[model samples]
Target: MTEQRVAIVTGAAQGIGAAIARELAADGHKVVVADLNLEGASAVAQEIDGVAKLLDISDEAAVARVVGEVVDEFGRIDILVNNAGLVPFTPWEKLDFAEWKRVFDVNVNGLYLMTKSAGDVMAQGGYGRIVNIASNTFVAGTPNCAHYVATKGAYIGFTRALAGEIGKHGITINAVAPGIIASEGVLSGPHADGFDYVVPMQAFARRGVPSDIGPAVAFLASEKASWITGQTLVVDGGHTRN
Candidate 1:
């Protein structure tokens, strides 16, 4: 029998995060749906038969508390999915410093905090998988969202550097870069128009969905991918092949 693992997925209240949570649960991992929205997180957790944790990943105290709580309950964390992030579609000139900082706060800083806290627990266990959610925009240099793209670029850089530092401890960190997925936030946000623009550019005829990202993340979090680390698997329907 395959041993069940425990996974903590941040920003898992809805959209891609929710999808990742569901996938991990289906893979037989005890999932914790951690999000800023307690209600949404609770609902998803209930549906998936997992735990719901209210978390502001950008907050140091919140990150620490959640990590400690999960470790206390589950005994160990096998996977940490840094899928919590904010995407704002603003022109470069209109993007303010505060907005840029907010993007980094959640996307970059929060990722670091979770990885650091979870990496400690994984080190003790001598096994862990860390999958970061990056974006294809960083490679394509997608316009009107400089702040969002920059954070993803940082994630890729961090993943590579951190992989080198943590590999000796039996923890592997990698990234999955999605290309213009049609999630709830993206569908309702100003960037919705870009969906049409993306379809024509993609090699795949259909639009990218949240589910398309799940398997890649789950694979990275699985034992099957033990040999892979410090790489960014782009699940963008071949939109911007690197």
Candidate 2:
């Protein structure tokens, strides 16, 4: 039987975030389902018998307050999954500064703020696991997605650097770069339109799902990953491998 632990997963309302929350809860962690979508978050949290929190990852004060609440209620946070991210498809040739900043605000800056606030609590506890969600597009060099790819690239770099700085504190920081997760939003959004033509993932035929990325996150957030940091686990089912 798995030991009971407390976990906080950001962006837990939908897509890969929801899957990760369910996976961790199944692993016996008291999962905290957090997202900007309160109703969505509540639904998932109830499904998993966990708590829900409405959070804007881009806001530092909100991040601090949410993390603080989790610690206060759970007594300890065993795992911190920085899964909140935004993937705005913008071409560099026409990318406006505002649009670029908006992407970074959620993807890059949000990750950093969460780490800063949550890292302190984890450090005090003397042990923690931090699994950051990255993207395989950065690895595959997927075109026409300059902003999304760049933010994820920065996340990978941050994961490695943070791992180096926090290892001594008994916290591990690693990243999971998943291929196209065929979530409801993805299938109904831009990727479903004409975005699939350019980046051909013919080998897999079908797109990757949330469940496909869950186990990787669970592993990285487990004690088994104590010594594994400064690495990016790419789970694209050979989509980006070619």
lDDT of 2 by residue, 118-178 (tens): 8888899889899999988898787667888999999899998888888888999999998
- Could you tell me the lDDT of residue 70 within candidate 1? 96
Per residue, candidate 1 scores C-alpha lDDT tens digits across 1-242 of 35799999999999999999999999999999999999999999999999999999999999999999999998999999999989889898889999889888888899889999989999999999999999999889999999889899999999999999999989999999999988999999888898788899999888889999999999999999999999999999989988
State the weakest 10-residue window (summed lDDT) of model 2. 193-202
> Taking the candidates one at a time, how many backbone clashes does each contain?
0, 0
Give each model a TM-score: 0.98, 0.95
lDDT for residue 64 in candidate 2, whole number 0-100 = 88
After superposition on all CA atoms, what RMSD does each candidate show versus the true structure? 0.8, 1.7
CA-lDDT, candidates in order: 0.93, 0.87
lDDT winner among the candidates? Answer: 1
